[model samples]
Target: MESKILVVYYSLEGNTKLIAETISEKLSSDILEIKPKKDIDSHSKMKYLIGGKQSVIKEKPELIPYDINVENYDILFIGTPVWAWTFAPAVRSFLESTNLKNKKIALFSCNGGANGKTFENMKDKLQGNEFLGQIEFKDPLKNDREENVEKARKWAYDICKLNIK
Candidate 1:
């Protein structure tokens, strides 16, 4: 039986989007981009302050319009950027809103250097789901784009193989 897969992610600096897009293409899965109701300023230092505060507090930001039906997808590849050593507030919101029980989840994150508890946080938020695996990219945007894409492709392939079994 063919599995229905979806790549859902929230990106502030486009690094996570790049990884999500690569994985979506590899899996031939539909993709959804999660957006906050209020936009965060990517260019401002205040963005870090607010994001860090929210992440540390585990605040869930309200999401904007999104139409993906999570129930249709059997496998969800969720991606987010690491902020304050955890997943972004937008991702937190998504997890809080979505019903993921019995779904197979694979997590991925884009980070500058430290990933401190990102995967752990995601797992904590998403209970009662089968976690396939997780992958992390270190400063993918500031580093080599080609290398990052290659890594994402390989990771996606590996995840797909595991899910198939």
Candidate 2:
């Protein structure tokens, strides 16, 4: 039987979502978008200040209830947009709330500047699981959208080859 897979992510400005969707499509996996109950307005100029502060402080924003059952998936591809040198607060909330032990977890991040400590911080929180792979994409929505998408697709395909065999 094939290992079940899921791509979970939170995108504030469509950067992370572009990569997440690409990976999900390539792997033929279910995708979950993490939506905070109270989300920051992307249109606001203060969004960087607000989102960065939340991420820096490690705040767990309340999430809109998602119907995904994580236990059903054997491999999880968690993606995030970098904020304050870390993953988004909504992704933080999901990691803390979900039961992810022993799962084959892979990570991906999209950032305008750098992934910073996003992978390290996520791995620290996601202890006790086997990491299949991890990848970082820079500005998937702008810099090179098609290239980034193709990278995500190829990365996801390679990860499955390593894990699903």
Candidate 3:
């Protein structure tokens, strides 16, 4: 059986977006990019400080209009950039607005170092869902691109093979 899949993500510096696009291509799924009503500063030294503070406080930044209905998809693949050892605040905002009860979810993150608490934080916020899988890519833009693409392809295939239903 073919499951309906949606790839939703928030990207800063374009790393997470690249990974999300690859996964969406591999799975031939619909993709949505989460954008904040107010864009976060990516070029400032205080970017980490501000992002980390919002994530720690669980602040849900207002998101721009996104057309895809969460209820229409069977499997949701959420991607985010690792900020302050956690998923970005924009992702938190997206999670807060959408209902994922009883849905199958797969997570992915792009980080410079460790995945940190990205997956853990997402699991915490997204309760009552069947978690299918999680994958992390380290510095895909600055580091090995070909290898990360292969890894993302394999991960997407594995997600398709999951017996979530």
Candidate 4:
């Protein structure tokens, strides 16, 4: 049987969104954009200060309504921007609220610098699911746009081509 896939992501500066979109396009999967009810301005200088603090404290902010049925999809591709060396708070909120079990998960992160502990932290929080794969992109909206897109496309293809359980 063919596997169903969903790409859920939270992107403030379009970096993570680009990666998510690329992966979705590659797999022809559904996409979910995670929006926080309250969000810090990415253009503001205080964004780092505020976002970093929230990430450090592992704050799970409220998310705008998103329609999804975890049971409807067999594979999940979750993407998020690396904030404070970790995944965004909005992702935390969604993950905590959603009941995801016995699902195949693939993680992707977008960061200006290093992905740091982003994937590790997310993996720790996301237990019980079989992770198909994980990939990281650097400034998808800015640096090496074509390369990043190509990488995401190939990665998504490879993951989906794997034996689906």
Measured on C-alpha atoms, candidate 1 has an lDDT of 0.91
For all predicted structures, in order, the TM-scores are 0.96, 0.97, 0.93, 0.95
Residue 142's lDDT in candidate 1: 84
* Each prediction's number of clashing residue pairs: 0, 0, 0, 0
Off by over 4 Å in 2: none
Across residues 43-115, which tens digit of lDDT does each residue of candidate 2 receive? 9999999999999889999999988898899999999999999999999999999888999999999888877
Candidate 2 lDDT (Cα, 0 to 1)? 0.92
> What local lDDT does model 4 show for residue 116?
86
Model 4: lDDT to the true structure: 0.89
Please provide, for model 4 over 1-165, each residue's C-alpha lDDT reduced to its tens digit, 9 standing for 90 to 100. 878899999999899999999989988899999999998898999998999999999998988887777668999999999999999999999888887888899999998887889889888878888998898888977888999899999999998888454
Can you list the residue pairs that collide in candidate 3?
none
Q: What digit string (tens of lDDT, one per residue) describes model 1 on residues 1-165?
A: 788999999999899999999999988889999998886888998998988999999888889978779888889999999999999999988998888899999999999989999999899988899999899998787899989999999988988887763
Q: Pairs clashing in candidate 1?
A: none
| Per-residue alpha-carbon lDDT of candidate 3 for residues 79-158, written as tens digits (9 for 90 to 100) | 99988788988998898888889888999999988778889889998999989899888989888998998899898888
Q: Which 10-residue window of candidate 4 scores lowest in summed lDDT?
A: 156-165
